[model samples]
Target chain A: MPTHRIDLSIAGLRLALETEAPPADLGVDERYGAFLADGDGEPDIRVVCRFGEPVAPEGKPDYTAEDIWSMYAGADGSWTAVITYPSPDDAPRPPALLSIDAKWRNAVLTEKRSPGLWQSVITAGAAELLIRTRLVLHDSLVMHGAALQVGDAAVILTGHSGAGKSTQAMLWQEAVGARPLCDDRAAIRADAGRRLVYGTPWAGTAGIAVNACAPLAAIIVLEQHTENELTPLTAAEALPMLLARSFLPYWDAALVGAAMGAALNILQGVPVYRLRCLPEAAAAEMVCARLGLR
Target chain B: MIRKDGFVVRDVGGSAVIVPTGARVLDLNGLVVLNDTGRLVWDALSAERSEDELVQCLTDRYDVSPDQARADVDELLQQFADLGIIQYAGQPI
Candidate 1:
């Protein structure tokens, strides 16, 4: 069968998805429309999709995630990721499997059944895991945060779930008409001596994702409060908080080390703040005023 | 004794921070900051070393007396044990 390939440029990384199925049959979600790339370039990561009975790795898994995903360390120093979906019908089926080599440059994704393009490509979490793991090698990471383009720069607001990341973004959009780059995951990397944040397709609940990037102005760690307050945090003080909110590849020690290095680089370049604020426009106004955006 | 599989120590903003990797992230959810002496002991534990050897490592590098080094090593090792950062071999090395 002829190989059908779709290339994507996400967060400045090129990913090529090759499958035996025809391109039209690949049910890629519309959310990925903005990230499609020209196929003339060399991809940083390439994932080949096929239909088969996915095999589990030998021995006990090295790591398990939320009872559905598992990671196994291969004897050749590679890693394999298996993602199982919860079926409402209580029927057992083959899980999705993705095996990447030591460098994570190439991968093979296998499934017993083809649900759709999005399910095989994105929903399986195989491509995302590869993207995140490969990102650390290039000194980049994805943080669980929302970012907005406020006057030619990106301001990232990060926190744990339900810490008002989206609420604050809504306030900023309402107050200053700031365009949200992404409402859930923000990809940050250094480019030409300037720290930049890019939007990813997985935009969480706000359902906003833009294929754009802006120089990072600052990073604000959000906390809910009755009144608006912003406090400066040193890089050392901010490292742990940022790491906690990042989608780190915790299954591998070398990847984690690279991620830590990338995070440290970001900390050294960008200023960090802790914002204790209410869910209102006034809080947004204070942040804009303090940042000299208004 | 050997250091845990995924606990890595790095220098962040002039401070030594110990970060966990792999499954260790579940056990230690936060970073561990180490003082100069604590870092010295941690580096010494890269190879299997006894508590006495760790004390000797500190005393050799710093101007502290043997008794003070031993006390510091004891405290540091206890903290490492409590945090599961180090594993013992049952027999003293």
Candidate 2:
């Protein structure tokens, strides 16, 4: 049979997978039923999950594959599912892979196993997702939960979950006719001696994804209150809040420190404010006034 | 031996710095640096647990002997006192 290959590009990482055996250095752990390997002695941790024939009894739950899906975790501490499709030459069956709840750091991998090779393909896809979204705390591209825009300049709204991030984006569109750069996740990168925030495909509850890039003007942390108001957050207050909300693994001390430093860099270069307000168009007015925007 | 709210805490460079929060950065002598295990112990210490109760809790959570736990607790308390991270609320243990 000919080999089938798939190449997936996600985030900023490139992943290539082929229908061939994996390298020998990979350690196989039967307990987790996966293969683990050290990718170039870096922090790139790789785990390969493979599946075989269903061994469950009739009317009983398929314990073999389903048990693995229960263990997968994403780079941002979010849970993700793995999808697999069976080979064409084999018996007509759907992809035989287990969905595990697991998380990975910086890693790139491709694997091929026996019988149910589709399982390896599924694992490869998951690895691509991990590499793309896993924020390299030291990198110039900083990820934050905010909507960014490019008009006179770039504007960002930083807020916690349920702190009206989506609502604020809507207001920008409705009132000022601003195009959203990103509704939930904004990737801030320095380009041409200017810091710019670009929108990614990842959308929060707002379901808004904008691929626009804009020079960052101001960063506003959203605060819910009874009235519309804007206040300046000192470096001390803002640093911890930003670090806590940052989407990175807290266990990695070096990464956490690097992320803090990057956040401080952003705070120092840009004007950051605590925008407290009710969910209304007036909140946009308050923000515009603070930014000196017309 | 770190007291809750007794130690001023701040997140310094991403790591948690349990100092007197308002204390100046130059006053390094007044702060107790906590390792991973020490941070775990600090998190577990509360007014709700008596000294004996704390020792028991430590023994349950960590793989340490009772005598070792007692010694560690005593040493940590002493360190906290020296750094002013905690103070004796009432009589000494």
RMSD each, Å: 3.0, 13.7
**iRMS values in order, in angstroms?**
1.7, 13.9
TM-score of each: 0.89, 0.51
Model 1's CAPRI class is medium
For model 2 chain A, the run of ten residues with the poorest summed lDDT: A25-34
> What does candidate 2's lDDT look like per residue over A1-294, in tens digits?
214333333233333333334432121121112223323332333333333443221232211122232113335543333334344345334333323223343232323345432234343234423443244532444456665553567687877777887788788778766677666667665455566676655566665555456778877888789998898876666665654455533323333345555666766666668888898988887677668765
Clashing pairs in 1: A27-A117
The Cα local distance difference test for each model comes to: 0.82, 0.52
Q: What is the alpha-carbon lDDT of model 1 when measured against the actual structure?
A: 0.82
As a whole number from 0 to 100, the lDDT of residue A167 in candidate 2 is 83
Which regions of candidate 2 are displaced past 4 Å? Answer: A1-138, A141-144, A150-152, B1-93
TM-score of chain B, candidates 1 onward in order = 0.88, 0.64
lDDT of 1 by residue, A138-201 (tens): 8999998898998888799998778899888988999988889999889998798778999988
